[model samples]
Target: MNIIFEESPKEVADSATGFDLFQDRSIVAIKVNDELRDLSHKLSDGDTVIGVSIDSDEGLSILRHSAAHLMAQAVQEIFDPAKLGIGPPIKDGFYFDFDVEEPFKPEDLKKIEKRMKELVGKSQRFVRREVSDEEARELMKNEPYKLELIGLKSADVGEGAAEVGAGTLSVYENINPDGTIAWMDLCRGPHLPNSRTVGKSFSLLRSAAAYWRGNENNKQLQRIYGTAWPTQEQHDAHLERLEEAAKRDHRKLGVDLDLFSFPEEIGSGLAVFHPKGGVIRRVMEDYSRKRHEEAGYEFVYSPHITKSNLFEISGHLQWYSDGMFPPMKLDAEYADDGTLKRQGQDYYLKPMNCPFHILIFRSRQRSYRELPLRMFEFGSVYRYEKSGVLHGLTRVRGMTQDDAHLFVSNEQLESELTNVLDFVLGLLRDYGLNDFYLELSTRDPENPKFVGSDELWERATSTLESVASASGLQLVPDPGGAAFYGPKISVQARDAIGRTWQMSTIQLDLNLPERFDLEYVGSDGERHRPIMIHRALFGSIERFFGVLTEHYAGHFPPWLAPVQVVGVPIADEFGDYLQKFADELRSHGVRIEVDHSDNRMQKKIRDHTMAKVPFILLAGARDQEAGTVSFRYRDGSQENDISLADARIKILKAINDKTQV
Candidate 1:
């Protein structure tokens, strides 16, 4: 029989399986008619089949999924009462949730990993079989979580979708060499052929408590995370990268450098910047303001809270109420007889600044001259983030967004977006983040949460895509990831450690102006609806600060360092000389400090270097006589006998150039 193989016709024997057609051991699975299936799947005449390499994205997912099943079987065997929840492969790893009486300790992971290795060595075959709903229920009767997932087979159950989808029910059996089922799981899988194929490159990472289905209202389940790779070298490389990431953790660096803190009494996700942190933030904002001013952006300010009606008019209350804080009732009046005389109004902390900017645009009538009016603000907004989801500074409840709204005509949409993208990239590069790619997040057609007509969405999405593509940066599609109002292009920046952070977003919004009834007098003498573009360069100041902190590992550049230059005297006598030099630099607006403490000069140098001071000026009797000081940099390199005048110029140049000295 002739069948299409990898887009080409090939002759194969009758009743041949993918295993028989593709004899390569690396081809773990096959795509039959665009659907992933196990290698054991039988082929039909004229069927199109393509091999799924074990190193490809889809192949890795299948390998990890099979690893997840192996780990689950090991867990159940080790812990008799553990009930299974969803086990899905995520980015670079996989996790399985279990309802256990006690949380898993570190030792538990070791045992599970050992059992998995033992199972892998046994070369058990993974056999898939389709069953009816009734049979699935009977097989998974003891697992209440699996039973619940079976009931939600026709619905979208988030991560549990990996287990049960709107299709025929199937289960994977780990068949031992003795022709008996060692274990079984309800899954929609195209897993590896056997346990040995999972390889020794897999490992159990750690365990954490996660709520089932990611809902606080649901029962908490103990989730064991693991990672699998096609080779041991790749697994070791991933572990090394993780170790480096831990060293660069912003929270730890923040505390160690005395930059910021999150006081428990204050809140869960609110961060308080110290004086040092404040210095960096002020410089960042000041530079941004200067750039915006040069770019024809007008500064604006809005209150932190507003009446709930504003959000209602903007469709935030209708579509994004879950993310907004609960409203506060106020301004109600009562009669002396305790009877209601006036109704109360509900006020809420503003979750976004776009609505306020839209109101400002509607406050006045303008002509084509002001059609591309750009309003900028460092607006503080509040969000009601669940406790479990909040991280150190990246995910916070309150943050200040470097937000701007551009009101442009239809003709100005593409150009304005192009300029915005350029401006965002340039500014981010100014802060030492140069590597970037663009992710276009478009609305999901099947989701009801997205507003706006299909025509408007397509126009906005296509225009943004054009702007992004024109910039020559790699553009990735993120379908179903847009905001409710419109599509947005987010700048994903890679930090020093190669981790991507979403730094800036340029959203082309046409629905907000329509909702707010915003208009501008065009050159044709008719009022026309203006298009609103939402742009946030840094996403949020607090989040950006954290990212920069991690990106540089607390060793900020000379321009952004809180204490740029510190003067150290060989003894207490030379303190006055170094102080005079520091005074001269201070006059040039340099953040210089002279250490005249009782500690030795070496101690002060060590202390300041530990604090990540960019430059250390060490003056001694010989240097004082020569009117010169030695330059000690953060990397411990030194320049001896630099004249005071020359040192001043070099220091200023480093600061002005934003060099990582």
Candidate 2:
């Protein structure tokens, strides 16, 4: 009998249990059917496969996931009878869920680390095998979470899921050289070559409680988080970066500086700003409003609550409803009807400001002269954030956005974006944040959440990238970070402590104009849709204020400090003299305070220093006679023997220049 064999590329090799076929020469991992498995899995002819390369994110995820399994295997070796849940890879790391009786103490982590090292030394290999659903269920029956996950497949992907191309599932097992299973997980995995190949590239970071499947209603499971890199040096660098992040944690600084408080009685995620914090926020907003006014932006106001019908048309009801607060039903009695009846009308607190601003633009027909119309508003919006995800002001439920919308022609999009980026960077620098990076977030063609057509998305994304490049900014790609309606450019600022905070965004919108049917009469005498650019320089006033407090370490600059100057008279007699000097400073547009609280001059100075007052002018008989005042800074620098007028001039210059005193 004569057998026919087809010629193929040199990159592929013939495999067993098949006709002429090419082996995965470059694919580090392969997705077989609905499951991800190692490329070593013997493939049948025409098996659906998606190759994963070493440089790809999916490949990295597999490496992290495999690291997580190794961690669990190590824990089981040290602590026998330990229950295991699911271990999945997340952004930049991987976490394993465990149902241990007690929380894994810090000491427990050390022992687990020791065992992991031993396992890495053993140079064990990860083996894979194909198993049916019944076989998988029997193997994972001891693990409730894994069994639950297997159950969720049918539910998560409902009947007629075949339309989505979800086929039957399979499982892979990990085995040791003795052919005894070291550990096994119910996962779709395309892992690394073996334990020895995993390299010295992972570290156990922290452990916390996470609800199963992220559902609070489910039983809470202990989660061990760990990060793995392709190289050991990268892992060490990441650990160092984490240490830097902890130093910039706003919550720690908030307590140290007495800037804000989140009392449990007041509620989680809701914060109360202290006097100092309020002053910082006021100055920030006041200066922002001044700048916006100078830039020809017209201010507008909108109510916090709106009828549900408005959101339904804006597509927020269907897409972002989960992030919004639940609606309240209006009764018939409140609607001018005596009978108590359900009106079937719902009202919701606004979660964003764009829809309201769109209504303003559509209130009247615009003309070509009104092109590039810029409208600004310091709008406060509320979101229903999950308590588990809430942090300090950075992840709050209520905050105000320095929001604006620019209605311009498609031809004006690039210039408008350029101006917005420049304006954002300029204002940020005023607060002493000079370093920045730009992220151009474009639409994901696979995701249907985005509203605009592909053509519009391409035009908007290209325009944003061009503007960012022209501005000489380092643009990074943020896939799937775009808003529901359009792509955006996120401006990330590095603070004084070298920490990055996402404080500004400029988004190009084409969906809203079409939804609202807004148009402007162009020079051609034809009704044309106006391109909208939505931007927020300070993403939120509360969040930015929090970041600023930590960035300055609570020692704000003179111009922005609530109390720019404090006068501490040496004795009771000199209080009157110092009061006059304080009044003079106040008249010069400085926020000055005179301390005569019956405390000693030393005590008063200490109190003012604690409050972070930029300038402290001490007056006594000797200095008062010479018409001079001894000046000091919050940093303990004293410029003695200076005339009061000269001291005032110096203080005013610092405040005017917004310098750190």
Q: In candidate 1, which residue ranges exceed 4 Å CA deviation? A: 1-59, 101-103, 121-171, 177-179, 187-201, 209-220, 230-236, 326-331, 341-346, 625-628
Tens-place lDDT per residue, model 1, 459-521, is 999999999999999999999999887899999999998889999999878678888888899
Candidate number of the best TM-score = 1
Taking all chains together, each candidate's TM-score versus the true structure is 0.87, 0.73
Q: Per-residue CA lDDT of candidate 2, range 1-661, in tens?
A: 1112232222223363221232543345666554555757665554555566544788788777778878888877766566777777777778787888788888888788677767777667676554667876898888776676666654553221211123344555566667777776665555665776555678787899987667779889888888887777778888887777676577876776677898889787778888867777888998999999998899999999999988987878888899999999774443466555556679999998989999998898889789789999999998999887887988898888889999999788888888888988999998888899999998788998888788889888988898999888788999988988899999998887676788899988878789888899999999999999989988888888878877887788998887888888999888888899888887888889889899999999999998778889898999889988898888899988899879878988997887787
Candidate 1, residue 187: lDDT: 92
Give the Cα lDDT of each candidate: 0.93, 0.79
Clashing residue pairs found in predicted model 1 = none
Predictions: Cα RMSD each = 3.8, 8.5
- Per-candidate clashes, comma-separated: 0, 0
